[model samples]
Target: MTARWKPNVTVAAVIERQGRYLLVEEQCPDGLRLNNPAGHLDPGESPAAGCARETLEETAHHFVPTALVGIYMARTLQPLEGQSEDVTYLRFAFTGTLGEFDASRTLDDGIVRTLWMTIEEIRASVERHRSPLLLQCVEDHAEGRRHPLELLHVDPSVAGAP
Candidate 1:
């Protein structure tokens, strides 16, 4: 029997302040690329919590997710040096205010730096984005597209339910 398909699940924080959106510049397999502070949902945590953790780890800034921006799915198949397989990603995007920064903390591996960019600037640099979700999440936040955080319900059976 063929194995069941499972797309990667990730959480992202869309933090905007003073007319700019926060983004992380990370070193990808191809090269350095820009993306929202996002990462895979770790075991035993809710998506919102995961977003907050990833944002802090990547940008050194604390993030409190107030609302869900949107859920997105995308498939990719890029040629590698040898071989590669098609991959799909399911992203849960959130928008929230950024809290204090931990200046003494170090960023995660592959994270070169963190910077804020205007929507126009982000739009013009699509080629440098780690994935299309980067622009999509920013645009959605700009358009005032957001759902209540209560939209996501985690049952008690799930580990670390809060």
Candidate 2:
């Protein structure tokens, strides 16, 4: 029997302050790359909650997701060890308010540091991005493409209720 295919699910926080957007520099298989503060969605948590958690882990800043920016899907060949495999990612992008930074926290593995970049700078660094969605999410947020957070309904069963 063939194995079932499942797209990896992730959540990202598109945080803007003044005229810059928050981004993370992380180590990737190809090299260092920039991306929105994002990570895989954890089990038993809503996408917004996952975004908040990933933002804190990657940027050491508290994030409160206010709106859903957009959902994106992309497929790529990811290198693992000496082999490459096709991978599909389903990402939930969100716009939100950034709160206080925690100086005592350490960033997640592979995450080097967080920085703020203008849209122009981001546009110029497309080749250095982890994925194209990095710029797309920021552009969507800049264009005021937002949907109410109420659009996502997390049923209790997501927490493993019987």
Candidate 3:
């Protein structure tokens, strides 16, 4: 049988403060890349929770996912490592408040540093993004795109399923 196929549901944090947006510089297979603090949804957590956790892991910042900026589906043809193959992903993006930074925390592996970038700067670095959604997330956020946090409900039974 062919392997079961499913698009990866992920969350991204588009954190803006003082005219700049938060971004993380990380090492991807393609080389150094920039992106919103994001990661795959883990078991037993809501999308907001996933964004909060990923933000902390990637940037050491307390992330409060206050709004759902948008739901995004992205596909990229990327060569798999150590194999003659390609892969893709579907990302869900969110925008919210960035709280206090925790200096004691360590960033995730392959993550180098976190910085703030203005929209113009972000637009100019299109080539540095891990995927097109990087800039799209930010643009949507800048356009006042927002959804009530309650739009995503975590069914307790499904959440707790093993």
Candidate 4:
């Protein structure tokens, strides 16, 4: 039988303060790469809530996801060995206001540092991006592309205890 197909679900925070966008420099299989504060969705949480949690964990900052930036779907052109099937990603990107930084908190492992970058700078270094979604999400955020949080409905059945 063919292996069941599924896309990885992820959430990201596209946070912009002043003219620079927030990004995380992290270690990846290929090398160190830049990406928005993002990660896989946990077992039981709304996409917005997932974004908020991931942003905080990865950056040590409070992020309140106010709007959905966009839904992105991309397939991996090549799969690493030992994979059972093609891999795709369903990314829920959000635009939000960042709150107080917890300097006392430690950033997630594999996260080297968090830095702010201008759009031009981001565009110039596409080679260093962790994924294309990194730049696409930022560009969409800069273009005023946002949908109401209501667009995503989280059923109560899957709402795990906080």
Best by TM-score: 2
**What order do candidates take by TM-score, descending?**
2, 1, 3, 4
Off by over 4 Å in 1: 78-81, 160-162
TM-scores for candidates 1 onward, in order: 0.95, 0.97, 0.93, 0.92
RMSD (CA, angstroms), candidate 1: 1.8
lDDT of 4 by residue, 61-134 (tens): 99999999999998754334544345688999999889999999899999999999999999999999987889
lDDT (C-alpha, whole model) for all candidates: 0.93, 0.94, 0.87, 0.91
Please report how far candidate 1 places residue 154 from its true position, in Å.
0.4
Model 3: worst 10 consecutive residues (lDDT sum):
79-88
Model 3 C-alpha lDDT per residue in residues 1-162, reported as the tens digit of each score: 899878888899998888799999999877899999999999888888899999999999998888899998877766466553444566767777788889999999999999999999999999999877999889999999999988878788757764
| Number of the top-ranking candidate, with lDDT as the measure | 2
RMSD values for the candidates in order, in angstroms, are 1.8, 0.8, 1.6, 2.5
Q: Model 1 — TM-score against the truth? A: 0.95
Clashing pairs in 2: none
Model 2: residues >4 Å from true position, as ranges?
none
